[model samples]
Target: MQMGIVRRSVGALLAVIVLLGAVPVGAAEKSAPRHSAQAIGKAERAMQEITAQAARETATAEMQDTRISSVMLHWTPYPAAVRYAVRVLRGSVGAPMKTIATMEYVYTTGLHLPLMAYGAVDDLYWTVQPLGYDGTPLAAASEPCPVREAEADPAAPALTTEYAAMPYAPLYPVYSWVPLAGQKEHEVEVYRREVGHDRYVHTLRGGEYDVYDDTPFTVPGTYVYRVRGVTAAGMPISNWSAYGSFTVAERTPIAALGDSITHGGGAITVPPSYQLYDWESYCTVPVKNLGRSGDTTEAMLERFERDVLPFAPRVLIIMGGVNDYRVGIYGAETVRNLAALREKCRAHGITPIFLTATPIRPALMTARMTINTPPSDWWAHRDYVNNWVMQQEHSIDVATVLSDADGELEEGYTTDGLHPDLTGKKYIGQTVDSYLRTHFAYASAEAERRVRMLKNMEKTS
Candidate 1:
């Protein structure tokens, strides 16, 4: 019976070979049948089914591995720590542990490691070291703690903008939040708090991580905003983030406008959201911060009409040009942009206060941020811009206080060589405060006069 079965299999194979040999090679090629659209569609659907099955299998495996591999590390917050350093280790049963990864700057107290990061390791541990503002170790490294897995859940967006203190909100407040994974879109809703209920004021949708609300809030009332993530199909993916509330007065008395320096924040990892890093926070005079991070002179000028007009500030402190000169933009062009900003302020009856651009320390900048290589003649351009600033009617020489004898940013005053740290910010804020204290009447008179004239125009219209 086995011999008979083998003979039959051989005979079938020979028949197939003979049948294939009978067809002329070129004829088979020429007569090949074209697939119908339906057939192609079926093939594509089948491929998609296979791909989706593979993805599902991969997701299931990942979920299982995540049960044992994902880790959320938390430690008591150290008093002097501006940031923390986290080190991950791997080890075997008998061998000693070896360092696998080191995160030099962690802004928050808790760090989450996903499955993909350490799924392959059977034994993993981590340690946290507190670091001061100057990157000095504030405390000894914590004992290595064994990584334990916890169930992972999708997180809602975390709001970054805050208006908790008095003199509540900026005119053109930037609403920003940390984005969530797999978030395709975001929905934002603004509500004005009324006597008995919250009234809906605005609703907007965008794909970006932040929305700069161009509409000026002129009313003296409290407003709240909440944001949530949405899927591409318009389905909600996350619950609404906690409402960020702010109160708006009739108008801001003084406002600062420029690039990152004016926006606040230093020590590299810390963001402008922290009041400690904001120069405005150190100033005795109440000044609203209208500054946005990463704004070039051109960008600042472009946003002046939309961002500044809303606040209707009496005095606008302008400190920019660092972002320009460092990127090799011609000094004359920056001056032109600044001049345009000045003209716009004057046209709108606002006092334009110019602040001299600070110098950069290329060596420290390179060490901390390799991508920020300033041009060889960056200082010359800075000098040119500062010279232009000094010629303006109202100017503050912040650069003079922050610069060393060699014209570079004083090493002690800065962390990244570009942005002035707390000490430098304090000096700048104090200088501005002193100047304002002496000239408050003049700035206020001019601003008030403009407000009256605009109101008169409105009545006539």
Candidate 2:
């Protein structure tokens, strides 16, 4: 990990060359500004309210005063906003925020969101990021709008860990947990809740915050895990939290492979930091970011076997093609390269998850470099690759969310249209997270439950 990171300095140098050396395509006509002065002023005021220092979470015997039934994230409506995506946070304003779900529509100035069986009452923070007519985010996200859960629980019981992925294990399955209050030591029970079986497999004792169950899982099928707290005397304390599931196969980490986008980069420099954005910082699953700036599909392939195969990840999210298209590489060649990557993963028994290339804002692209006589129809090429990707299994449709109706990056999501800002990057990360939460659920019971809930929300929304 320490490598470029020194290499990041090297990548930074390469990135500047890519930005300046490359010319943007797709010339456009200017119209009404995407944002107006009035809207910006209102947003500024809303930011002040949302980002204001949060008061200390006062401890109360009742705790009920802090419980909130609903959370509403609000912001000033921008003239260009056709839809708004709201992210809700439950802790401090400045700390990393967990994006629960993205609302599909912007009915009014604000959206009232539901919680995940949130029984605790205290603090919640939200940010509203507007979207263009196309799915692209429209403007800067509203500062973390703080909300309080106005309900109380009987007790502030010790909760479980917010583990990322719970993949299968033949060696030792690692489980992460939060420490239970009032207990210096706690017991954790790991259950083997797979199909055709229902029982506690292991009641681990005196383990660290993260318990690694070394027991060999001889069973070769999908395993769902649920952990519950216990006293040193093997007494139960809190109820079991949500189940974390992973299959028992070639237990490997998940790999995110791509170019600068995968490397977490935003276009433009001088003031904005060039350091790669840590997309996994908020992910629910533990994923290795193997993204490098200025890597085309060919460059990615050159290093694939060496960097990725070593981990033998359970799933590999392969998102490439944009960098290939940047240099006017034929769409077919890019597709061929991606197909090769997919085949390699399949050959190694790795699950392949592909993502469509994100959209580019033409205005930003044009301003970045000299418009060279490149491929006349870059849009067609992009669509061709995206169409092919959509036909495959385990495909992540991020391009749809980032593109405007005109097939360009939504102005709000990018400063240069080729790369995403924090607002855009967060949206992409959360969207991938939503997909993973559903896909990794080997147990259909939990999977179906979430799908049904999303459908209901869609109907009501």
Model 1 lDDT per residue over 1-461, tens place: 33444455456555555655576777666656753444446545655665565556666666564555345466654543668899888875456778888887666555655556666545777889989766799789887777653224335666766456423355556666655544658888999988789999997775635565656576766789988888777678878988887766556768888888887667765555446567876677777677777789999999887777777888889999999999999899999999999999989998899999988899888887755688999999999999999999999999987889999999988778888988888888889988887878666454445445444543453
Q: Model 2: per-residue lDDT, tens digit, 231-256?
A: 67777665664465544332235667
TM-score of 2: 0.42
| Consecutive 10-residue window with the lowest summed lDDT within model 2 | 269-278
Candidate 2 stretches with Cα past 4 Å from truth are 1-252, 270-276, 369-374, 442-461
Would you estimate the TM-scores of all the predictions? 0.60, 0.42
Q: What is the C-alpha local distance difference test score of each model?
A: 0.74, 0.57
lDDT of 2: 0.57
| C-alpha root-mean-square deviation, each candidate | 17.2, 28.9
